[model samples]
Target: MNPTHHRRRQLRSVGTITAGAALAAVLAACGSTAGATAQNAGAGTSSGSSAAAGQPVSGGTLTLALDGDPTCIDPAQTSLTNTLSLGAQFTDTLVDQDFETGEIVPALAEKWEISDDATEFTFHLRDGVTFSDGTPLDAAAVKANFDGIIDLGAASFLGSSYLADYVGTDVVDDSTAKVTFKTPNVPFLQAAATATLGILSPATNKLTADERCQGELVGSGPFVLSKYDLTSQVVLTRRAGYAWPSAAAEHQGEAYVETVVLPIVKETGVRAGGLQSAEFDGIFQPAVQDQDALEQAGFTLTSRANPGNVQSLFANTFRPLVAEEAVRQAFQKAIDRDEFNATLFNARYAVPSSVLSPTTPGYTDLSADLVYDPEGAKALLDGAGWTVGADGIREKDGTKLVLKLLSSEATKSAAELTQNQLKEVGIGVEIEIPESSQSFKVRSAGDWDYTFSGLTRADPDTLRRDFWSGGQPNSAAHLTESPLDDKILAQKAEVDTEKRWAIVAEIQKEIITQGYDIPYGSQLQIYATRDGVQGLRLDASSRLRLYDTWVQASS
Candidate 1:
């Protein structure tokens, strides 16, 4: 959201559509049956919780703690984990996909249709929807938001990759909006579900992108931002006349509680203590240690496997030692994924066997392709002719097999595990610890040889820019340029569903086989919540659909 936040500067819409009625066919084949039973399925949340077992409770403020601060309320231009805080108070996307099922349900626009050729999308806005500011939410307001993002050139990531050729949008009437692309973009439908594309009120659109940072934010949701002290806390009160666009939520009318406060408590220990002391009704406790205490106290713990977000070590291909295919293969085989998953995760995680996690559509079981084989690893390096020297360190033609690894100081555990894993393969890893901001600058400059990194993207296009090649998305050490990749990327926007997938699989194979995207480990967007909350859907994209949530007040 900052003017200087230019990581993937020249990127496109970064959408991954795979259209052509393929999704329709897939849904039809899967049938209309609900996969999980509601009685047992993980559904319920603090956001949509009712006051009683059946009745909607009219007023109460919900306070929460976070490990970090939200730098921007603009979803289109941020990547921090804290966007979940902003998401509740603001959103009006044409469609918000159920993060888990990838359902193209209503959000701001009640319904929509894609052109036969797939290049044009027409949205039918709901009749009575209004922004939190009380102004009518119309097509014109939606058009203004898109234009603002482009003219400002402020969305460094979205503009550069996914929306590179974002042409323009038009408002046909107060109820109709049309977004036309230069080509048939596969990711547009799905990207519309992301926070990056969340609709802004006409009021917010009037403020310059930079000027928006000076004060509180507004959104067309069940909650309203009542107070804000940028670096301290955000207080939101329920919109009394709220009318939801879809039946996805249980409480479709006015919210159950009166208010909710998102507090800026940044320490894990302190937040855990607050939850322990009942200083808060519920808190987001991510660590395993907090889970036990919460459960022991009769709190309900909700868990689900998250899709599209990955955590891994990306090698910088610029250094001569890491440039070879054999070295990358060796690095892959040397680490015991089970050891790390067991020791570090308490068996709560899976070793990432492929780039596409299990939650992603068309995800295949690729454990064989990711088997741990030390002897095979040594053979690959030997075949590449990197002889084992007397020091047990690898060397080829006087160049040492070495790299400088960098990551945020906050996630030191995963970063350190990567260090030990690479060392097992006879590679030398140098660690660099920088504060979150400076570390970001260091990675964007492509200055490191390898770093522990991950992305929380819902579609395959996210994988394309991250590892397919060139510029900012390629955090694979030093070799960041990709002309052939650029060639393949151009057609992705227009290709049909099946063909696009074939292309995506090709890109994944290319990155792995060519040693660009070093396959690391698979992970889910995990969370820890206390009991008393009920009926929240943890969507596949790892967001909590809080509309249906209800709670049992202390009797």
Candidate 2:
């Protein structure tokens, strides 16, 4: 037999192991964020055709349409939804996290152990796993990737955020590696299950960050990147002789689809039209207005509420106009989240009750605090010495109370709606729509008074990642000082479930009561798939996982 055939035979013979009893109990108790489910027209219905019977017959191409180009295909370098979805197909993480149960099961690593204080994690590599590039997946390879991620520094936003305290990974042996952190990282195990911590081939360590972003990376995933064109499409071909699969994944061995094609379709209408014409098998983020029509036209709509941060407008506290607590309070009170949702989203979305999404763990309902009170807002503005001028805009100290709101195409519509809502209370909101690539740069520079975005993660540690002022140079809130910082930090170290959650609660209350995060609604990832597109589902973090996804044969 050829070497490839022999390797495949050996890999197929490899057995899997269950996670440690201690770690499994902790993870299971924590539970996952909301499970991602595929429902036709938001009703519980499978996307696959009824006529297509028998087994999952594969060997077809699955073409998915994306809203924008994933400028970087490197998993560690970006947490953007598009890039993450793409990375999930071509990369594998150390462990697999259950979407419904939050159990930390084996993936590339067959088993793992956690230290008593939760500061250290030891992962045992599975036997007979090799990267598509022919590199051995071992303990040394794990160390190299961790070191490389730390070296990427701020460039790996999500990765850097996950690995906050850098100690290093120790190669105990060829298959055993121990990861250590300076501070207790209770979230590290769950973080390991995220694509940001997905393992890459050690050979990729030789490439610069830029080269890696340009798709110069290799993984032991079921699929390998065959073509990556930033302007057009990304093509993933099923890796031959692949055997190891995540324990959380529904199936074992190779992916059913021979090839997966992701084409950038900037216009939602264009994507919808393509799906209708059978030009695309599935499309990401189909507009709310188009959801019903697509479902009526025989397409299935799969949606999962993105956990962690809600779609919120964060106050850049450094901005002059928003520096005063009164102004910030007025801004929060003026927002009619109900109206915003009814008007813009056809009331399909759940209005935000707190800084964290309702789907997130430890989410506290602060709807009473988030009540829409325009008169109260006017009172706050008036008391702050901001008088409504003849132009119907608030003015104080020879300056119009106009706040610059930074937004992107994704949130531009919502921002515009906010502008009108704020206008009612005599507060002028100047929406500054920036290029997608420039959005982060502008926010990081503190050039806007308010900005809109959301972070999706299963854990509440996402709050610290986005809101904690220290170490987070790109903190949207621009919080120089706050008690919330302490609460955020405390939650990370508290391993006791009740204690950690209590801290998380205080953090959410602090974020909203102090006017740091003005939430609008839950962030939901909705995709439309034509019939016969089976097994498409979102992972715990609301990212697309195409491993078990298959395209049914046409009758």
Candidate 3:
């Protein structure tokens, strides 16, 4: 038999081991097991027949449309949603999450064990794995990846946040590696399943962070980066001799599609039209208005609620006018979250009840303070010594009650609607939509009163990455040292399942009570695919996992 056939035969005999049974059981006590079922229920509408029931076939090119150019190809440096969407195709994490049950499963690492204190984790690497560059994937490579991310510092916002408590890693043997943390990092295991912590080859790790961001990284995933044009497109070719795959994966060998192409198409109309005309196999972030038409045309629309902080208008308390707690509370009570979901998202998105979404692991309902009451909002402003002028804008001490709201082109419509809503409550909002890169600069400089954004992750510790002032400074509300920060620290330090959740609940309540994160609604990462495509799935972080995706032979 040929070498490829022999490898397949060997893989068939090696059974897959799925981990995190205890973790899944513990989470079930906190929330429903079918967390993603509600979001995926409308996947292929009743009017259209399911296209996922065909036999898998190989040897076809899958053309996917991206909303914008990926910010970076390096997993550690990628911070944008579009970048994560593409990075998932070429990077393999130590672990993977079960889409249906949210359980951690084996991926690059065959299995792992967490210390009783939850401060240390040891992983057993899979044998015979090799990077696209033909470099061996071993314990040393994993250590280099983690160490490299920590060394990148602020340049790698996501990576730095993920490894904030990381102390060091020790290679126990050729296949065994132990990772140590300063504090009890209960979320580190789940984080290991994310692309932010994906391992790169030793050669790739040796390059400077800037060089890796320019697409010089190598990974051991099913696809290899064949061509990367930062401004235009990215092409990936299937990797041969890849027998190992995650336990959640449908098949264990090479990907069904030989080549995958991701082209940056910023316009929603163009992407939707291309998918409709069969010019593209799939499209990311399909317009809400186009969902009905796309489904009616027999395309499948799949979505999952991102599992971290909801999309919110974060009030920078450090700003002058917003420094007043009353004004910040008024901003939270003034806008109608239900209206925003209805008008902008067509109610397809989930209305968030807390700083964390329902799909998040430690989510708790704190919606009592999030209700919309324009009169209450006005009363709060009035009590704060702000008087409405002839122009309908409130003023106090000769300063106009105007706040600048920063956003990107994608969120311009929602920002405009928010402007009109706040205007009714005697607050003036100036909407500024800047270029993507410049938007980051504006946020980092703290030049805006409010910013629209969200962070995606499967663990509740994502709060630390966003809210911890000592970490990513400008990502979240930019609130330095507060009672909520203390609670977040407490939650991160505790490892007991129930006790940790109690602390997490209190943290969410404190965030809502303080009005730092004024959540609008939960955001769903939506993708639309033409009929006859099968096996496409969304991982826990709501990124597309196309390893098992196949194009069914045309009938």
Candidate 4:
């Protein structure tokens, strides 16, 4: 338990960028303390790729494998990592935050200004940028995208949450657009850098949100979506005459990889095998046990910790088993986080200290509150009048202490482990792993006592989206109106970094202390690439940036 583990780690590398002095003041006031400038230094590239240190060579397809299929490919709607990663290839954001310095830099928008109150953001667009559909990227397009997200409502997922206090976006002129919020939103600039906020062609406004999920949307990115099939794969062909790239990109005219193919390989072992056999150029989320073998065979494993919600099991308060406050607190104490990580994952994963992952800004160290305490758990259950029955299961008022746990294939391992641990304290956990497409339907129906899930974002406001009562895409814990809701709302409007972070810290404390959510381990995005892959780097939000990624041809 080193004290340094609880402190924020410094960014490993540095690069210089020059913006206006006024922008510097905005970074100091709104970005610096809020972790808007914070860049992930935890990205590690293991030895073995043949072109790992070589100069880029263009014109080859990078056939990457994704562990899960994205339900939606629409930038405005998806919140899943795999979906956003795919979208990033075919979509571009308004601005780009530097991966090293976290400075706001030009992308589709050449320059921008933040009002003193942090409510209005004005952007000046670059000339001659057009979507693959021949639609010009202009202020009107930006307004259309924003207005569309607002119209989609919760279906827009992260986009709607990011634009929570949306007032409106004013089309100042052909090139300039001013986006104003009802309250001060310090996180909006960095939010703009995310793929979820990636701009789209105004023609997409005609499509319903579900139709957009079918992957017919056009974007002005380095690649174009040629095909999307749920059962097979999603293909992106290189966009010719493409000149726009994020300021953080290494080098770009068009993506060096000529055509990018993402095959939906749902099994982790199959993905690893595909990479090992050279059937795939890269694979996402190789199993922890397969890491050593993959690296030994000359494949490079790149990893970056996700910065929003940790891999957590959120209690459904509406469920009878977890409805009791004492029972919820007992469930937290009964599980051993260290054992869970050590058994299921390896050193690559971290034990989460708070509801928010350590890589997130405004993360508070709540390891003290999260320590393993089986004896304390037993006592709490006893005091709550639940007696251990002859079958070694807790019982009270003729009801067995069995709780239902909902999980997907990706989260099933952790859910199964949680079930085993809670059994030690006379609690019965019924595991229910549903199909990926059925996950949302099952969760929305409230058929389970606890659901295992996580989210990846660069800001602390992610907590608001997860725990706040009225948060977007629906709250994970299904929390109702409470003091926690007030704090979550307050932090969003408080533009002052220190004060806002203090409020975020309080929100974490309240979530942990009240037993609303139990974080088991931090979520890290890992990819295994074949020997010839080069220049692949992760963006600020841990999504793979493939603009500079190129694969060398075999000699």
lDDT of each: 0.60, 0.79, 0.78, 0.79
**Best of the two (2, 4) by TM-score:** 2
Candidate 2 lDDT, 1-555, residue by residue in tens: 565344334323432121122222322443423322353221122221212225776688999989888888898888788888788888888997675555677898898998878889999999998999998999999999889999998899788888888699999999999999999898998889888888888889879999999998898888999999987999999999889988877788889899999888766556655665567888988767666566555567677677788888887777788779999888889999998888777544677788887666677878899999999999998999999999999898899999899888768778989999999999988889878777777778888888887888878998887788884456656776677788888898888888898999888887887788899877777887766777776777777888777887543
Please count the clashing residue pairs in each candidate, in the order shown.
42, 0, 0, 0
lDDT of 4 by residue, 513-549 (tens): 7788998988777787865787777766778778888
lDDT of 3 by residue, 1-555 (tens): 565344334333433221122222322443421211114422112111123565778878888888888767787887777777667777788998876556789988998999888789999999998898888889999999899988888878887777767899999997888999987877888888888888788898889977888898789988988888987888989988777788978787988889989988776666655664466788888777666556555567777778888888887777888788888889888989888888877656877788887777778887787899999999999999999999999999999999999888878877998899999999999998888768777788887888888888878887887777665454677776777778888787787878988999888887777777889867788787866677777777777888888886433
**Candidate 1, position 456, lDDT:** 60
Say which prediction, candidate 3 or candidate 4, comes out ahead on lDDT: 4
Off by over 4 Å in 1: 1-58, 152-156, 470-491
How does model 1 score by TM-score?
0.84
Candidate number that wins on lDDT, 2 or 3: 2
Model 3 off-target regions past 4 Å? 1-38, 41-51
Residue 176 in candidate 4, Cα distance off native in Å: 1.2
